[model samples]
Target: MKLIFYGEKLSNIRKLNGLSRKELAEQLDITEQAIWQYENDSMLPRIDVLNKLGQLFNVDTKYFFTQEYLIHKVSEEKIAYRAEDRESRKKTKLEITFVNFLDYYINFFEQNLLIPQMPIMDIREKTLKMLQETNEDRNECIKKIAEFVRTELGLENNKDLMYTLEKSGIYIVEKKLGTQIDAYSTVTQDGRLYIVLGTVKKSAVRRNFDLAHELGHLLLHDDVDMDILSSADLKTIETEAHLFASAFLLPEMQFVKDFQSLTRKSNPDYYIELKRKYLVSIAAMEMRAYALGLLTYQENRYFWGQLNKKQYKSFEPLDDEIPPVRPGKVRALLKFVLDKEVMEIEEICKEVHIRPDFLSYLFNLETDFFKPYLTTQKDYFGHTEVIPIGDFRDKTSTR
Candidate 1:
């Protein structure tokens, strides 16, 4: 039996930790070239150094030696980034790597468990089919699709959007994706759809809008090749998604009925009540109303002026009143697995070749989430038994 050292694993972990080779070398008290050598398979760290590497990264020492799992590879081209500055390929790569890690962790636990079938694929198919089958133009098509989604998902009025999305099998994760990015959506090669929401500027209404926008991307732009898209192409898709989100959140029929009461259609304050009812921002509602032809173009412009005058653009009324909804599906599933003893936390750590703390960090879980589930055994014969978890030996490394 022979053990192989995988340099790619070291590189990925380093990148995920946001460490440059020079920075990592400073921590390791080694030369920068040595870190590069270790990551490039030109040199292997000694036993003590390997253990230190594991401790630094909060992974089992064998993680560096073990063959990495083959989850769906995430590329920047496949991601719909909801940001203005989409130039950071490094950041994109880091995020995608993190998502892949999440994918592997999830797949490990969900192997035998029955989960809800993801509804996005079917919805996307139906949306495309409708586009082909109907004579409706793009905006009309989007509005009809949005209405259809609302009906299918049973999102009546202001029903809890986050809960419904999770119930419909969309894996949502709230992450610190910088202030520039609002959110991003991706469908893995295995058809697992994920929407990573940014925690920045995350009010309830804003979160809802982000979710709907990403949902629009998932349904409308799943087949788009983002790499080759020009600035204009990106803008066009963004506009389309925004329109979809507005329509989806504020269903035309219901919103029009609500809008009928606002005699002062140009007054931003008049839409506050509707905002509370729909749990959408005043600006968003104004846009929706204008899109629906309920507000004249001049009325919409006046509403914006009033909105600016009130200084409600950054933080609108009811932004604090409406409690932001947190994603609970992953947390709930983890609790269930732990409560049912399907897999102990420590055991899962060993299987995944990561430390319990790192595992918790990846999922944004509490620091002691795995503490209660960890079991302690008394030492016998002055020697603790060690069980090999994964293939202890491998001839080659595969990414």
Candidate 2:
């Protein structure tokens, strides 16, 4: 059924605000069912209520007048054939809100900002056999590719992966994507590739791994649409990406050479120092060692058992000391535009349909950092100058 006046925008806005129907209805002096009906397009609010909603949602009432202005669900949007929902819940609440934010961000930038080109490889699958192969083979393939990419960029095996991607023109955005989603990558219609990282709360080790994993997808699976994959196929692709991440971060030769130098092969504590050196998890280092044939299966089992016994499963030493890496590429682009006076910050905020405060929060910026952009001497005109507030008189005040 067609919704009335694209009412789903209301749903998106309400969810973005973290409001339930009952709460929103209570504030709007309406019944929960009424709000539902309004959101279903079966009804529309009166003019006054519409004005109130505009203020409440910080969107113009005219935003409801067209379907183009309404937002689609995240999974239902551009990367429609792409986002994999492995969780039992089809769409989590946080996922919905995050997608809405992502859509707004992508749209605003695509419409207004100029994006730089990234020097990324479009890896073509050698054969159906390769995609259908064992995990070890896939990891081997990815390792070579990752190493080549690093060499081309003049980056070391342990270099900043995020910085490299940013400098190479891949746009990255970091946000609290809830625990379920670590990251997702997609190419826009204009061919701009983006990696959105959600595990910003996790340690740098996990986040770095995620960035590489997504990069793996960006390079290797550019032609494959994830939505079309069977469950088995999905698992294989996920495993392939994971193997890529493992191999990419711990370059086989470099890591093997370093591991051989360690006094004890079985000590997880020894890997702790390696973890600091490589910026990867102890578990990952253990797996890499096992993958490299340095540790026998029995030895690997014993190593994991010892780690489990020592309670190093989740939190490890220096985990908190290492901050989660953030994506500065998009932020850098924004700063570039602002610094060059390409457009006023107010124009950016207005174009994005958000207040400066919300922009700051989304970008992890300080409060009132964009306040200077909001200062307008004239109301929508270039000519009118601000009359001093101190010069106002009781008889002829223009406050």
Candidate 3:
């Protein structure tokens, strides 16, 4: 029998868009029976019907005709040489699509309801230039970045900024998707952006790096038409993101001046004292010292070595004891919608563009942990009760 690719493609797109056959048929102005026939390979749609299907599903017509549909179930390596490349392209495309969708949704909500506008910062050019400038006082740079984010968003702290992002439909999930992957960010087809972190490297410093890197991708490279990063390119991107993150997290001039003043007494424990003030790793403090010319290369290397050898107390908490995972922005927004009754449970799942099963699993595993803290109930007697949903364990054992 000839392979009927369109049937599968149609079905996949329909499901991904969270549309039932009848619903899709209604949208396309076609009979529900026609959709059933098309999905079962009993009949193929005509060119007019194909065009309507493409528009309705927001997928390219070529996608239905190509063998790429069959490759979906194939082993990762056995697929086409460009499989990885194609997947990457698909992800980027989806990211842009989702971002646009979010922009629209945010606009709709603000106009129809009393929702606050989400703060958006376009730091792409600024971030790229930061990487190109040498002799840049790194600490001052970080401070400026942080101040910019704070001022733009009117946030007083990182926690507030995180809350705003979560409420604005961005989701950050912590999981080990793959080895050495660190983290990946993508906006779902329904317009929610997600940053999924690999939990293998649980160091707060590393997690900070991954978060900044993923944010860099979200802000700057989302429109770029490339998927795989070359080692050199990856390094360059990582460097830029690090600079952005550092500037954002640790403001330079303030930190430096503070460090200088704190160490002015020449106390042998000056570095240790400074680490406590900064909430940074000892290694980070050492780098800051070197950047400030407070320590020579030899001294910096020696201190780092000593740190690795556990000769001195490390500043940051141990990675194993305290992983850097946090509740993502996407979960926050979904919770808000559900709590506010702005969206029903099914609607929330549909808007976020996740399967009912997957959405339920994600909510129970991630959002349910903090549901109580985020929700409040009012009884008929005019008394308020706060329900608390505690921490959750991973439902997927392997992940």
Backbone clash count for every predicted candidate, in the order shown: 0, 1, 12
lDDT of 3 by residue, 42-141 (tens): 8988889888876565455655665421222211111111123334543333333323333344333333345443334334345445534736675455
lDDT of each: 0.78, 0.65, 0.49
Candidate 3 CA-lDDT value: 0.49
Comparing 1 and 3 on lDDT, the stronger one: 1
Question: Which of 2 and 3 is ahead in TM-score?
Answer: 2
How high is each candidate's TM-score? 0.89, 0.77, 0.54
**Root mean square deviation (Cα) for candidate 3:** 11.5
lDDT of 2: 0.65
Name the runs in model 2 displaced over 4 angstroms.
1-8, 11-32, 47-52, 65-85, 88-116, 121-139, 157-159, 348-353, 361-367, 376-399
Give me the overall lDDT of model 1. 0.78
Better of 1 and 3 by TM-score: 1
Q: What residue pairs clash in candidate 2, if any at all?
A: 4-41
Error of 2 at 190 (Å): 3.4
lDDT of 1 by residue, 256-361 (tens): 9989888898988887888888988989888777877888788878888989999999988887777777777777667556666667777777776888888777
Off by over 4 Å in 1: 1-3, 29-31, 46-49, 375-399
